[model samples]
Target: MSERATPVKPTEEQEREQSRETERPSDGGADAAGPGPNADGATATEPVTTGAEAVVRALENAGVEYAFGVQGGAIMPVYDALFDSEIYHVTMAHEQGAAHAADAYGVVAGDPGVCLATSGPGATNLVTGIADADMDSDPVLALTGQVPTAFVGNDAFQETDTTGVTTPITKDNTFSSDPDRVGSDVSEAFALAREGRPGPTLVDLPKDVTNAVTDREPDEPRVPDTYHVQEEADPEIVEAAARRIEEAKKPAMLLGGGVIKGNASDVCREFAIEHEIPVITTMPGIGSFSEDHELSLEMAGMHGTGYANMAITHCDTLIAIGTRFDDRLTGGIETFAPDAEVIHVDIDPAEISKNIHADYPLVGDAATVVEQLREAVETSPKAKKWRAQCQQWKSDYSMAYEVPEDEPVQPQFVVEALDEATSDRAVVTTGVGQHQMWACQYWTFTEPRTWVSSHGLGTMGYGLPAAIGARLAADDDQEVVCIDGDGSFLMTIQELSVAVREDLDITVAVLNNEYIGMVRQWQDAFFEGRHSASDYHWMPEFDKLAEAFGAKGFRIDDYDEVADTIEAALAYDGPSVIDVHIDPQANVYPMVPSGGDNGQFALTEDQL
Candidate 1:
């Protein structure tokens, strides 16, 4: 039997008070831009610029370097303002692509990425991407056009409730009602997106508001006074947590996406290595710690490494940093970490015990709290034998697959070949599916901010657009590659045009299986082999489609063609596509059925 420790919880009254305090800013609203010249050097007396100009000026003041969007009627004025600005804007083929591109930019650039969309259909198109950002806690700012204030309720041609539609998915949203305050409203949204527990935020711009003339400038980006974040954990809690770590017979580190977002990856790596603690990364936390290190157990949860899941199940002290104990990672909560006392660290307090219970809840910035533990702990855990056991598990369940000369190409082989072809500075973006799992399982990620994908929302068609944004955000020397499934690649294939027009150097490899592979796999396992709408046999030749879009195209059908095709595609100066045909019946393994124990993951179909 495992011993459990109860965590302290705040009373209902105190919780209610804290909720009210966050909503009511101590300073009534954002500060006025003052009486002097705006960013364009135009004074209030001049009143020479439209509210649209102020909107673009606010972005300039926020140090926005790039924006992604699609042009439409209601948003044309803002686009006109953008035409004269220094910020580089990429006109995407679809609004969804625009939002995904901006989101990927945020993931790599470590700043709040910006996106724009017009009213109605345009606004709705961004919902998927916005929700993806919200679920993953990526910092992004979305500017959406709204119909004229007069026509809001009357249902004007392109009118929709942009703010209302996005309220649930955004960290915060505002309707720019006043011309003078519109710029400040955008500034506030940008600040809120990046300040505390980063997530996407939105600003809705009505036609009348942006069309009106306004010389008032925007306040510098700043969060509201009432929005305070705890920077350090309580000293007593840190000391206690440190003592627990010191006394641990088997300790393990679980790092999540927040480590990279909070700039805590370096500190996490140092702490884990110095103490010889085994490290397990969540799917989103793939690149937070180098997988090649001796103490690393790689990823944990459903499709995670066997050793990583073993460590989570058996460790005596679980140091979980920045993770929210997502269901996919925790499996059955009762079975998860049954033998361990969880030390949960996160910037957001609400996430501490919302999922699995936390024995030591260190609520603060990820890096700051880790530093506190570092200072408090005087001795490392005595886990030499435990470390040996973890290494043994790693050896027992190695990620290896066979490729015969007579059979079809294996997707895993293709992923490993791609990894061998790219430089270490390469950035990878993937759409959600079996291909996503193959890439995650095979690629050796060694740096922070290198792996980008749709984790929480699992949005398909994210790869191509994300590659476009990552290409723009990354250093010139860094390569951007999109690994996608056939079903996923077709959803937003129009984005290839944007890549070609911009002369972006990105390689796209579509692992073609002619089916909704993940769904098909589930049907085979649990649904009694009922493929039902999962077979996508009538798919277009993606390579030919790429050529039609004016990009270099290649095809790889057999094992001999793998390396050369990838090499040629990467050698292309502009955007390139490689359609790699793989075994249609192939399925990803090391999966735990939904809500199954992580320690009891299956390695093959029969086993499952």
Candidate 2:
């Protein structure tokens, strides 16, 4: 894989320079040249600039150093401009990779990630990733080049309504056929993506717009404050929610990814402590509640900690903050916490009661709403019984199944070894599968924003690229680990090159079970124990592949060596792969078969 010439490692002085550049006057005109008259009586025959230059210049002004995309016929001009400029462009094997990488980059960098593709199929391929960003409230700017304006809507070669296709999923979208509107439209798209309650946005640029000459002086785009959501909390609604909290016997806080997104964990913790309530988080919300906190119930729903699930099952009142109660967190929605009266708070109005019912729908920012709720709940006495019950549940169901032998080969053992070796400090990204579940179950995330995985999107091959993006975003001297399964690793295993060339300290921890673990588990529990197509018949020696990439590699068959190997991998200065072989029969327990309700979960091998 060819690498970019200049990696984005800015010094402190460079940071200061970038900051000053942001504050500098926004003159969009390309340094006074081209068709304009010169001070002397000489005619300048320089090439005329176009709207595409202005759009690209705005990206540079925003400190966008990289763009991910797969170039197509309609997008060739934009790609040409990008290559000619100082911005780095990464070619992706699949547009999904581009979109996901961009999404991860945004999450890690706290800015809008840029992605580009052409019309029709190329643009369609990015739909899933765009939707992922939309659902997660991630900041991503997706640009798709359209067919010539005159040829649009006639089913011209490679033409599709990219904006129309993305409008439902994107926070905002625009289509620009006029050459003059490209810069402002693209600037608006990027600004909208990074504003309050950030999300993905799209700008469809016609081919003619890219090639058309613009003699008019480019105006630096203005960023309006309208993109941010207003914080307007109704005192009456806050009091009603508080009164419900005050009157309840068993109240538990269901923390979602939204809490982290809104940076409302402090407020959440304040409310929890003030009201003496326990917290149960969703998979994406794993780190929102501190694991060290006495009142924290790590996770809730299918594959969640047993204590977390039971707390949700038994709680009398549920205060859901910054969460939409997705199916994974609810098991089956119909039977989830039938006794609890739900109080939902979110910035988006449509999310209040979309899936699960909310007894109190207070639409506002999580931080503001939670602060108000905290103020109202300042007088509630501590509920000793409720906290004690939650603690008992945590003590009972939260324990990990013991790896019986000194040479035991359990996924839990591998994850535990990695956790112990790493001290749970690094940002861990996981591919979607049984390994992902195991990481969620056994790996303790002590800090917020340290765990990244495909929770809602559930996309395979997310771990490696996500880890790569994370390391890039860290921009510091810190290690990142990609916990992957065999099936998921094979999806985009080519990303190993990215880690090697960039020399990122990323360890690929492959929990090799010789099977697609999740589907196999499903088959064993519900499909009458028939394995069918779930088995991975054969796999390459991953260690050899890692060595081929000019990186260190290790294969651990004995569980006793797991801890030492993980530590060694961490000590390595560059990327390394640790393939840990484990039992194929091992499956994450407390499984609720698809379509089954909460009580329908299988607890032990006897139930299986």
Candidate 3:
């Protein structure tokens, strides 16, 4: 697995120097060269670049550095064109890995991540990752190849309706039939993915269209101002929200993924600090505010911190910011914030009343709305009492688990050790399940864009690929960690080849509990402990598997070795996997059963 060098386009000064050299005459003549006509009798102002070249150039203009995918027959034209472009093409073992990696790249890079795949199975394989991006509102551009235009309706080999398959999962989908339009279509796809309420966008390229020769030059990349239009809350609505906050005795704020997307952490923090309001977050909104902040209540609902759930349940006025109050966070609509008057602020108007009713709806960007509210809001007299109560709850209902000195390692302990090792600089990603919840619960994310997970889709095998993407998008010095479970890790474990081949600096900590831990836990709590197919009688030796894939691997069972193993994995120059044998029977505590209200959490063994 050798690394490839893909240099970025030279700076403007370098371009000018190259142009001067090219235009200079070898004979030192007065006239060097003039525009000439081609065989088509058109003035040759610029060399004819193919549609495939146009697509690659457009992506470069848009500041894209990498494109992830597995190549196939229909998509070979784009790969051929990529040889001359600055963008690095990452070849993955599976198309699904490419899609997940691209999705995670979009989340960490603050730009639309690009992924390419072929028609038929390749396009179908991208559906899960596209759905994940749509559910989480991450911006990703999915490009797929199609059968030649003439044979598209004839059901040519390897042909499928790429646009139709991706329509529902993407923000927008389009098919290109004309070679000349590929550049502009690709540009629009990126814009749609990144505009208000960011999501995945799909562009299907016909095989002939990419291979066709075209004289049309690529369109200039759309300016950010053309699409990233920010909406500000109306003054009246802002004032009304402030008035509601002032009137309430006990007020709390619910932060969601929108805050991170809108980059409103600083303003959100200021608003909370000035108003002395307690803050809680949704699963996708974990890092919007620092968990260590004095006013922060961490996560709320389902597997959220007990105090945060209690705070939301008891607050008189609930200010929901950049969040959609999904079922996981709300539990039951009728019981969620039953007594509180809700004031919702979001960039998307549809989300305002989609879930929980908003007594005062401010349809605008979260950062802009928070800034306005900060200017108009005043400290309430009851804030002091509410703050004291929240602090007490945090102290009394802290997330706790007892680790027997002689028993197998607990999953939570592994997360704690990893957190201590990373020191908040690592971008943490997780697959859906117990490992996901434990990572969210135990890791202290002090900054935005540091925590990535498939929240809405809850896709298994998302951790490793997403971590790979995050590492590629992040600064060279930044560390990336994937907290995975045995069940989820195996789903797309083949992605280890990409990580190892690229020499990415990533640490994968596998909580090797030999069962589908979440399902088994649910069975124990709700179904009389009937394991069914949840148990894994045979498991792969992950350390050996890692070594076979050309990466470092470690297997640890003793609790005392967890910290040292994690530190060594992080210190390794290339990708490494630390497989810790965790207690299979260990269950994630402080859970709110399905349809249960925030206040009705199952806390202990007695409750189970």
For model 1, how does the per-residue alpha-carbon lDDT over 1-608 read when each residue is reduced to its tens digit?
A: 01111011113545424422332112221111222344677542343278888888889789887788987888877876775554557778999999999999999999898999999999999999999999999999999988888889898998889899999999999999898999889999999999879999999999889999887888889998899999899889899999999999999999999999999999999999889999999998989999889998999988888889999999999999999889989999999999999999999999998998999999999999999999888999999999999999999888888888889999999999999999887999999999999888899899988999999999999999999989878876788899999999999999999887766788999999999999999999999999999999999998998999999999999999999899999988888999999999889988988899999999999888
Output the number of the TM-score-best candidate: 1
**Deviating ranges (above 4 Å) for candidate 3:** 1-48, 223-230, 379-381, 605-608
The clash number for model 2 is 0
lDDT of 2 by residue, 1-608 (tens): 12222134454546534532442222232211222244453321232277676567667656776677888988776775564344556566678778877887787677888889988999998998899888778889998988998998899999888888898999888887766767767777888887667799998888889878775433444456555575756789888888888888888999888887777878888778766789888887777877778888887777777777777887888999888788877877888888889999888887888988888888888898888887787467346898898899777765568676754388888887787776445778889999999898888876667777777778888888777766666555445788999998888788787667556677899999989999998887778889998889697778888999887899988866887888888788778998888888888877765545665566774674
| lDDT of the structure predicted as candidate 2 | 0.76
Q: What clash pairs does model 3 have? A: none
Error of 3 at 432 (Å): 1.0
**Clash count, one per candidate:** 0, 0, 0
Model 2 residue runs over 4 Å out of place are 1-48, 84-87, 153-157, 215-230, 406-408, 423-425
lDDT values of the candidates?
0.88, 0.76, 0.84
Q: After superposition, how far is residue 93 of candidate 2 from its true place, in Å?
A: 3.7
